[model samples]
Every structure is written in structure tokens, then in C-alpha cells.
Target: MSLDLTLCPDCGAPAEVEWRAVMESTDGPVEHARVRCLRGHWYLLPVASLAGPGCRLAQSPTSFRE
Candidate 1:
């Protein structure tokens, strides 16, 4: 399935969403999508609300420093 993206929150331009991966869990399946704006800004979408229509920003774990 394809992702339905809204207007970019960063540039107010149209954004495109591409499916990246899906994590299977006992609770259910979680879908992940990559969103990119026309200006080339990228963001990771963590869809905890899989069965619904919502998502949250996901920061890369590897980007953290101790």
C-alpha cells in the first residue's frame, strides 16, 4: 500500500511518503514511512497508531551520544 501524505510541516509544500519497513509485534504490526519534502528535508515517521491514521516523529537511535 502507498502512504497518504499531507502538506509538509517544514516548507508547506507537498511531501512524498515512501514505505520503508514494517515491524511485527504481538500487539500488531507497526508501519514505518520516510517523508521527504520538495526542499529535500527528510523525516522518519513512527506509526504507533498502526490501525489508525496518525504518527509521530522518530529520532535515529544511533544519533545519540553517551
Candidate 2:
């Protein structure tokens, strides 16, 4: 399992990745991650999960509004 570095909005702590999915998009491939922070704040974050690209996660252009 990998760690999602997104800090909780309510608290300052790294979040835990619960699940991940890669979807094909017109822009390219996008990865969605379901995370829960140390404070138990749950949210969905769009990140670049592509391997051998960058060491850090990049936010998606379109936020997961749903």
C-alpha cells in the first residue's frame, strides 16, 4: 500500500490511500484516489499515478466534484 501525501483539510496530517483507479480520458490517463486522513477526513483526490514519470503526485486538471 502507498501513502497519499495530501494533508487533511481539517487537520495537518498525511492521508491514507484506501483505493485507486486509473481512467482513460481525452486529456490522458487520470488516477483517482480515495483517501482518509489521520483525522478521519475522507475525500477523493485526483492524482497522476503513472509510473516512471515523477516522484510526486500531480493534481488532476478536473477535480472530482462528485
Candidate 3:
């Protein structure tokens, strides 16, 4: 099955996500993504996958941390 793209659970809006940077953390390179909803709900997604853009995964409702 084709994997579904990342979407805002609050408004069901498609997440406008892009890689911001790779910070050096204790775990290693922490991939960061900037996501914003149509309603201007900004969010930062901390993930490990850096395959490429347009890659998104389901995030928790409270995943919008800073």
C-alpha cells in the first residue's frame, strides 16, 4: 500500500513540511522539519528519516513542539 503523507490532525490540512536542519544531539543527527497548516499552525517535527523531501509520517496530536 502507498504510504500516506503527513497531515495536520487538528484541521486535516496537509502539512507544509520541509527539512530545516540536522542538529547534533546525543542520539545523533536529529532531523528537523518545519510544518505549517493552512490555518497557520506552525510546528516542528523531530524525525530520523532524511531520505528526502515530501516524506512525512503520522505525528501525535501533541507533536507540535516548539
Candidate 4:
């Protein structure tokens, strides 16, 4: 299965790759996300699914927004 991470908002690099693994937010499960690039750079993204269109990171830091 292909990872659904977003592009880096700073470097335009696509995060969430295979083998490297994905992580969720620890800030309490936000609708958005923060992922790492191939170069190991981290960035913000929308919470997408690993199963389908609307999923989330398996186990990473999450932030809940109000």
C-alpha cells in the first residue's frame, strides 16, 4: 500500500514513504498531520488514510484542533 503523506510545505518534498514508516501527532489527534520527507525533513499535512481516502497515520504525533 502507498503512503498518503503530503508534500512538505517548506521544501515541496513528498513525505510518507514505504520502509521509512509513517507517524501520527501526539498533540491529541488533529485533523491535519506532520510528516517527514525522504531527506528526513518534517512538514505539515492533512490526515489521510492508509486504508482509504479518509484515514490517518498509524502511530505518530497528533494534534486536535478546535
lDDT of each: 0.53, 0.55, 0.55, 0.46
Model 4 residue 34 lDDT score: 54
* Model 3, runs deviating above 4 Å: 1-5, 48-66
Model 2 alpha-carbon miss at residue 57, Å? 13
TM-score (C-alpha) between model 3 and the true structure: 0.51
- TM-scores of the models, in the order given: 0.45, 0.49, 0.51, 0.38
- The global Cα lDDT (0 to 1) of model 2 is 0.55
Residue 27 in candidate 2, Cα distance off native in Å: 2.3
lDDT of model 3 at residue 34? Answer: 71
Q: Write the per-residue lDDT of candidate 1 for residues 1-66, one digit (tens) a residue.
A: 544554455765455565567867687887776777767887766644222333221222122222
Q: Is 2 or 4 the stronger prediction by TM-score?
A: 2
What is candidate 1's local distance difference test score?
Answer: 0.53
The candidate that achieves the highest TM-score relative to the unseen native structure: 3
RMSD each, Å: 12.2, 10.3, 9.7, 11.8
lDDT of 3 by residue, 1-66 (tens): 332246654676656564476777887788677767668776676754422344233544333443
Which model, 1 or 3, shows the larger lDDT? 3
The regions of model 2 sitting more than 4 angstroms off are 1-6, 24-26, 49-66
Tell me the deviation in Å of residue 37 in model 4: 0.8
Better of 2 and 3 by TM-score: 3
